[model samples]
Target: MLSDLLMLAAAVVAGRDIVVKAVRARTVGIDLLVSVAAVGAVIIGNFWEAAAVTFLFAIGHALEAATLNKTRSALAELVAVAPDTAVVLRDGEQREVPAAQVRMGEIVLVKNGAKVPVDGQVVAGTGAVDEASITGESIPVEKAKSDAVFAGTVSRGGFLQVLATGIGADTTLARIIHRVEEAQDAKARTQTFIDRFSKWYTPGVMMLALVAGLLSGDVVLALTLLVIGCPGALVISIPVAIVAGIGRAARDGILIKGGEYLETSAKISAVAVDKTGTLTEGRPELTDVVVLDPALDRTELLRWAAAAEAGSEHPLARPILDTARAEGVAPVGVPGTVTPVPGKGIVSDVGGRRVLIGNPALLEQYGVTDDAGAAEAARGLAAEGKTPMIVAVGRTVAGVVAVADRVRADAARMVARLHSAGVEKVVMLTGDTRLVAESIGRAAGIDEVRASLLPEDKLDAVSELQREGHTVAMVGDGVNDAPALATADIGVAMGAAGSAVAVETADIALMGDNLLKLPESISLAKRTVNVMRQNISIALITVVLLLGGVFAGGVTMSAGMLVHEASVLVVIVNAMRLMRRTQGSTATPRSRWSPARPREAVDA
Candidate 1:
């Protein structure tokens, strides 16, 4: 009698809130059904069974809460990294204040081992900042004047005075947190169907239990059915997987938009990458100086080219001027009377002699004969992916000065890794000439090349890929690629730490500039989707077997509750596997070219 009273008290303690919540909400939940089943067991004098059912459920709830929080721990870690205090220069005095209180344009001081309190530009001093929180890069980046620094990064050494550009909730960390929460909560199409099924499955199970008990006159069997038919695993299977998958990606500095985007990312087959800033270094550099005039040496050729470009504002001018200065061949001052011809090059008067630096068209425009085979030399440079400029002094061609963008050391490795990751085609799209684009493509191991494309033409290329039944992912960094990015199946933005638009709008935003993350992201998405499928199968098979066991008569109430809780724990633990780092998650492939050979050789 004492055991029965104690067990009844235990059931009431475990079930009161559930009963009250159901009453207040005027709805029937699985918890209410379980509570009813426990109470019925207690009334039938099955004291141990009643106590075991409610106790197991209470234990399961506690475990679920703890483990679910662990699945979401990655985002919690991000929030914890947010700066709390800041040292700001107010009225030329350093003052400590809350990070959120620091006003924009105010100078913030960052000392050694201090966290950067705001996203801003470095105005003075130097430091090595560990930006792992923002970019997931383990190495510390060297920070100096005019360099952009983000909040939550640590200054490993030295000091800095930064002007606050973003503060409080406007910071990137806050935005990342917000995006992660929204992504975790978003539902996929399969999840939506399962949710709908669970809603009706609970009440339907209750009705089946009621009819079975009345017709068969077996009250204990009906109670056991209620304990096992909780839909615990089915309801939480997808959500836990989604939370763990997205959170793990965020920790690695890969931001997937949401569940829907994650689903689409798994289906990506083709990838289109921009040449400049994506596959190669965006900055052009002086590579070759061909002397057509036997009288002038390489240095003299560079000097004449730099003199002609000294007064021009073209994108290719800085490389010439910088190289000239490095080689001690820079002109004394800027050139005189510079005339820039669109689609050609610049013409200027240098040292009282007319200097022309451009393509063959510019030479023809000025009626300068291709004396000394300057045009053929320019074609040779162009074929090797170099932007060739003819240097002419008076009517005689001096030399052909060539400049080319340096291809990234990791470009070829990135292509190979993408293919290894199951990508069907890796295409290079660029506004550069056909020869230049093809040269880069060959070096990078790209499968196809779409050259000399305008911004709109890039979008057309992506659409054409889609029309061919290939799901395309476009990776780019500039505003011109934004249209193609939006039109592709998956729009990937790299080096996205400073770009607010890319951070918010890209399907997958890789915070660091590393190209390896591209293949890693796709691999992760594929693995995550596989986990989701496995979890769903586990849930459905568990439910089917439990229903079968209850009808065939050997599963008791205590045994049913234990199995139900075990299934839930299994699903949670399966999802947590995604949180751990795998070999493919962090692989940085080696360059295909030998270390002894210069990267410029490939560009040539």
Candidate 2:
């Protein structure tokens, strides 16, 4: 009798909060059902059954909370890495203050091995920063003056004075954390249906338990029915899967916006990529120098062109100046009196004579005829996918110099992997001319080319693909592509570690600059969605079998609770499989291509 009374006290200790919460909320939940079953067992003189039910429920709730937090550990780690304090240079004296108190435009000092406290420009000194926290790239990137640095990245080797541009919640790390939390909390379509089903299913089960007790006069059987019909596994199935899948992705530096975006990413049939920065290196290099006038020679032609461009800031000017300096024919100083002929080129005084370097349009604008076959040479270079500039010396054509942006080493391989991962088409979109865009498309193994696009024109291309019943993913890195990126089914931002806007606004943000991560993100999404379906099925089947066993007279109150707890554990363990690193996640196969033969011959 004494031992039975102690067991009764244990049941009250475990179940008081649940009973009080049910009373205050004025709603029917699984907690109330379990509490009522325990009380009914006690009133029927089943002291052992009451103690067992309440003790098991308490232990399961504790375990569930602990394991659920583990699934969200990735986001937790991000929060822990956020810097709490910063060393600021206030009034020329170094002062330590809370990271949130650091004002914009104030200089903050980052010592070796210290965490970067704000997103800002490195104004003085240099360092190597391990940016794994931001970009998910493990290698330390060299940061010099004028380079951008993000908060939460560590300074590995040198000291730096950074001008704070973003602090506290405005930093990229903060935005990433907010996006991840929102994603984990957002419900999928299936989850919404399950929620509604659970609400009515619990109350209906309680009514059935009362009817069974009335018809058969078996109090124990009615209480056993309540124990097995708790809907514990069904309630937790989808949330655990979503949290695990999204948290694992965050660890790998892939930010999936939410459950809906994850669902959409699994159906991506086409990917439209910007050519300049996505397929080819955004930087141009000097490639060819053809002398139209044999009398002037290569050195004289380059010298005149370099002098004309020395005072200009055009995108193509750096390559010409760099090549001239390397060849020992660069201009001694900046040119005198430079005039930019809009959309054509520049005119400058080199050695007291007018030197013009641009397209044929510039020569026509200035009434300088190309008598040395310079126009013909420029046409040949342009046909080869190079930007050619005509160099003229006082109305006489000197030579044609050309530059081209080199394709990234992994671009063609990225296309092949996309095809292997089930993408039906890879299209190249760019503002470049048709010749240049097609040339890049062929080299990158793309199926279609939409060139000479304005910023808005890219959006129209994405819309056109959708009209054709394709789910399009647009990948880009610049502000100009923001419209198209926002309009696509999935907006993927590449090399987004440096841009806070990309981290916040992109549907999917790749922390590193790897091209292969694009296909990998889609593949992971498909796998995660598949796992979610499997888990939901496991939960519902477990619930059905338990209910059948109870009515068939094989399941008792204690046995039903055991099976229900076991099913919940099963669902959670299944979702944990997403945390493992996939085999061949990093390897990219090379696509075969030859410069001597056309792309058709090699690809075919």
lDDT of each: 0.84, 0.82
Candidate 1 residue lDDT tens string, 1-604: 8877898898778767656765675556668777878888988989788888888888888898899999999999998889899999888788999998999999999999999989999999998888888877777888889988899989999999999998887777777888889989999777888878877888998998899999999999888888888888888888888889898899888999888888788888999999888897777888988898889899888888888888987777878899999989888888778987765667899988999887777888899998688777767877887777888899898988888887898889899999988899999988776777888899999999998788899999999999999989999874879899989989998888866877888989988877888888888888888888988888779878987988888788988889988988999999999999878665332121111111111112
Runs off by more than 4 Å, candidate 2:
24-27, 90-93, 210-217, 303-314, 324-385, 390-398, 585-604
lDDT of 2 by residue, 11-61 (tens): 888778766766676668878888889999999988788888888887787
Q: Report lDDT (Cα) of residue 155, candidate 1.
A: 92
TM-scores for all predictions: 0.91, 0.87
Model 1, poorest ten-residue lDDT window? Answer: 593-602
Top model number, lDDT: 1
Error of 1 at 244 (Å): 1.1
TM-score of 1: 0.91
Best TM-score among the predictions, by candidate number? 1
C-alpha root-mean-square deviation, each candidate: 4.1, 5.2
